[model samples]
Target: MPKPASASALFSGPFALATLSESDGPAFPALVRPDEKVLDLRVALGDPALTVRGLLEQWPTVLTRLHELASTERESGESYRPLAQFRVHAPVEPRQVFQSGANYRQHVIDLHVAHRAPGDERPEQERRAEAAEIMDRRAAQDLPYVFLGLPSSITGPYDDVTLPEWAQQPDWELELAAVIGRPACRVPVEEALEYVAGYTIANDLTDRATVFRRDMPQIGTDWLRSKNAPGFTPLGPWIVPSDSVGDLDDLQLNLKLNGEVMQDESTKDMIFGVARMVSYISQGARLLPGDLVLTGSPAGNGMHWGRLLRDGDVMDASITGLGAQRTRCVAEAR
Candidate 1:
């Protein structure tokens, strides 16, 4: 099981939150400490029906109460349990997941140049320069490319991902996920951050082979079959409140596959920041509490290294303030 780091590095605030399941009971929300101890919010707040999404729906009020709860020392008779006794699941059950694609400048350029047409014989530097220019134009004028992802595809941060047999080239795209705190529609870019409750880490696993529809050249990408397999999205060790996180642009995103560093970049490389992506998505779809808007991954995906995921490979992904998540890959049975 993956454990959180020390208090000084793991979280910027008093505590973070997570969803956990006991041996014989259903999943419940809890306040997690860096010391590996957890206090059940349902029992502490005296609301058994309370959930992470429910808390987010009432974010403003609940956040204040949470601050108060976090300030004081644990009182006698309070039920605090060790984190290891339970299973940690995705922090929130989002009604919708908005995924931003090609939002990172270098990532887009790298992919475009790497997957050049077979017959096209352009010098490597020339191809890269052309791709970079296109990205610059898109960043200045074009709107962000956003798509939907199924909530059912989410799995625990430390769970084993079952790679489907049909997926020939499974790849990893670790991204920063913004958790929405309130209902937002047609929000402006300047005000989009206000609707974000917190932040978490998400690995958006994709099957490279299924990315584009071979049968229909004009139809473009097929994200559903490429990305929405069960356990494809491994999200959260916990959520750190938005206020606790520092400048979004300064956050460092790093991912290691089988103990080798695959991705090491800062959010500064993103063409469209979190605010713009959120604002753009809200213009079309209503973003509800617990909804996740995944900012696109930075450069250095599996494709960049010409190496894709295989059975038994483990991916450890993390962002600056948010905690880390580890997922081991397993092959599907015949």
Candidate 2:
């Protein structure tokens, strides 16, 4: 119950948070090392609390303690487990998940141009210019488009993603996710970063074919149908602290499908940055500690490749400083 230090100060330390499963058992929270090994956080921190949720709830009070313990264990190099020895779980089981949509400038333009009606064809430069203009105007307006995601969709970073039997064109959207540590409601953009607990990598899987409700296209995107499949959201390798992340705008989002680089972009291209997205979504609702805000995926989705996810395909997604996620795709059993 101490006054929360600025995110810049909190993240300046070396500690990060993560969850892991041992022997295929339940998940436990741990302090993820910057290089290798996962320190048992519950015991490392002297156990005033437990679970990833506990870490976030008391982050302000324990941030310094976390740094001290992690630094000692790391420097001492004692009782460490190799990163690959255990199963990495979703960084946290969030109660609410907020996802930004088409927040990447180029990603939106690609979708616009790629899906344009045949009769609306125009020169590539012309189309690009138009899209750029729209984005510029939108940025001036300062409006962000966001949607809800189900907590049930979250899974381990290295887990298997099951392509539901009904899904035709499942796609991958590699994104940077912000973990909210402090509760926020109606917080202004300037003060929003203070509430951020950390950052993580999230693959916002989508079912492209079901994106729009054909019966009610006017009603807009069907986020639930398009995004909330079980294990659809592959999150984490680690929740790298916000200050540790340096500049959110410069983080590189890279996703390789079967060794072929598909999505390569910087968060600089986001139409609405992390602070903006968090502030916008927290207008009326309280963003609780441990809540996740996914900052939308960059372009190069399956729709653009004309090659959606297939059973046995492998996806490896990574963001600068936040570690990587490798998920194997499998067909859902009947």
Instruction: Highest lDDT: give the candidate number.
Output: 1
Encode model 2's per-residue lDDT on 190-264: one tens digit a residue.
999999989988999998889888899689789899899999998876788777787888888889998899999
Supply the global lDDT for candidate 2. 0.82
lDDT of 1 at 167: 98
Name the best candidate (by TM-score): 1
The 10 consecutive residues of candidate 2 with the worst lDDT sum are 1-10
The residue ranges of model 1 lying beyond 4 angstroms of the native Cα positions read 1-9, 75-77
Q: Tell me the alpha-carbon RMSD of every candidate.
A: 1.6, 5.9
For residue 128, give model 1's deviation from the true position in Å. Answer: 0.7
List residue ranges in candidate 2 displaced over 4 A: 1-13, 46-49, 74-78, 118-126
